[model samples]
Target: MDPATLIGIALAFIIVVVVNVMEGGNPMAMILIPPMLLVFGGTLVICLAGGTMGDAKLAMQGMVKAFTSPAPSAAQLVPELVTLADKARREGLLALEDYVADLDDPFLVKALTMAIDGTDPEELRDILEAEVHAKKAETKQAAKFWTAAGGYAPTIGIVGTVMGLIHVLEQLAQPEKLGHLIAGAFVATLWGVLSANALFLPLGARITRLGELEVAQMELVIEGVGALQAGSNPRLVAQRLRSLLPASQREEEAA
Candidate 1:
């Protein structure tokens, strides 16, 4: 799990709930149950019913990918790529075929296999870059789906509020139910705002970033492996890969 994302959300929600409860709002008013059902559950059912199961599943898969994947640190790939490059140089390119079988990353394996087999460098780059682009497109599709949901939610919330107001107006003959009806109506708006900022937007950005990082690392494998095949020195591979790293990370190691 991403410690920052998970912990920040938990701490913020706890603070919000505690503060609002102390402010004398109904304790159950802070309850996430009914609003969550209306916002998330209802939206999910509506989306699935509309035949966007693939999009919905991709959204959930994004969360799973983020949670399960421990991203390679910025400079982490350097040492590994250097070692692989050295091995490629010492042993003939055909030696990489043996290592390829041991590789777990499909992208890296595919890239190295192409390089070792003496495929044209441009063709290899094209094939790998195309895969990277396609993965990015898939990531964007998933992020866009959730972002679209975020956009729809506030309007849906407003619609829900209007529906609630309609119910409240029906009770205008009885002054007793007026306050409760109004409170329930406003819950819809609250659900909309909270869900947008707290959930959808953050999730979309997180997943998109994860996809980008994965693709970048794969591209590194592509570049470094290509260099290795072309007889570039391992030190040069390390230097080239370092250029792709974040400045902060580069600074940390420089220290």
Candidate 2:
């Protein structure tokens, strides 16, 4: 995890615990079974009911993958692609045919191979860009599921709070303790809101942004190689590819 994300999570938990201690209650109260069940169960029901089962399942898998495993960074890819571009320029585009096996990423290899096939520059751009958009849409579909789940979680939390309130109200003998019950019950809503904003929503956005950034870099490689294949000056091709970077990343050697 990024340091920023890690710090944010740590601070949120710290703040919650501090507040709970200030309330003269156990700091770990939220970890209690009733509150957890209310939050997760309610969110699950809302997601499963409001979204396709496939989307819900996909969203769960996405969240798991985001926490457990992250894909390689865009900067990590720059060297690999630069080598591919130099090789293509040196041996002719056709010569890249043999190196495709060394390339592991299906998307990158496909884009490079298409450029090597002497695909028209405009057509190559269109085809690769189209496929990128298609894959992006699919990837965003995974994020959208979490976004939709995030949207639904709060409402279900409110539902759970009301249910808790109803249950508490029915206990006539324990009326004096209703305040603590209600307070604890509302923790469900707190969990829902926090999970939505801090967890699912940000994670979904991060994955979407990362996917788009990587795709943009891949598109740059495709365009650069296309120009190289057409015998564009190396300086001109470098200039064109450099345009793909922001002013900051342009400082890289490839720029």
TM-score of each: 0.89, 0.82
User: lDDT per residue, candidate 1, 1-255, as tens digits?
Assistant: 556556555676677678878888875764556555677766656655654678778878876775566765546566767888888888878877777887767788888877877899999989998998989988987777667667766766777678789999999999999998898888887777767776677667777888877887777788887888787798898888888878876775355
Query: Best by lDDT, which number?
Result: 1
Candidate 2 lDDT (Cα, 0 to 1): 0.70
lDDT of each residue in 1-255, candidate 2, tens digit only: 444445566677788788879989786667757766777676767767776877777777766656655443444455565566677667777888888888777777777777777677888778877887876776777788777767877776787778788878887588788887887778778887877787667768766765676676667667666665676656666666666766656665344
How much is the lDDT of residue 34 in candidate 2?
73
**In terms of TM-score, how similar is model 2 to the real structure?**
0.82
Number of clashing residue pairs in every model?
0, 0
Tell me model 1's lDDT, rounded to 2 decimals: 0.75
User: Clashes in model 1: which pairs?
Assistant: none
Give candidate 1's total backbone clashes: 0
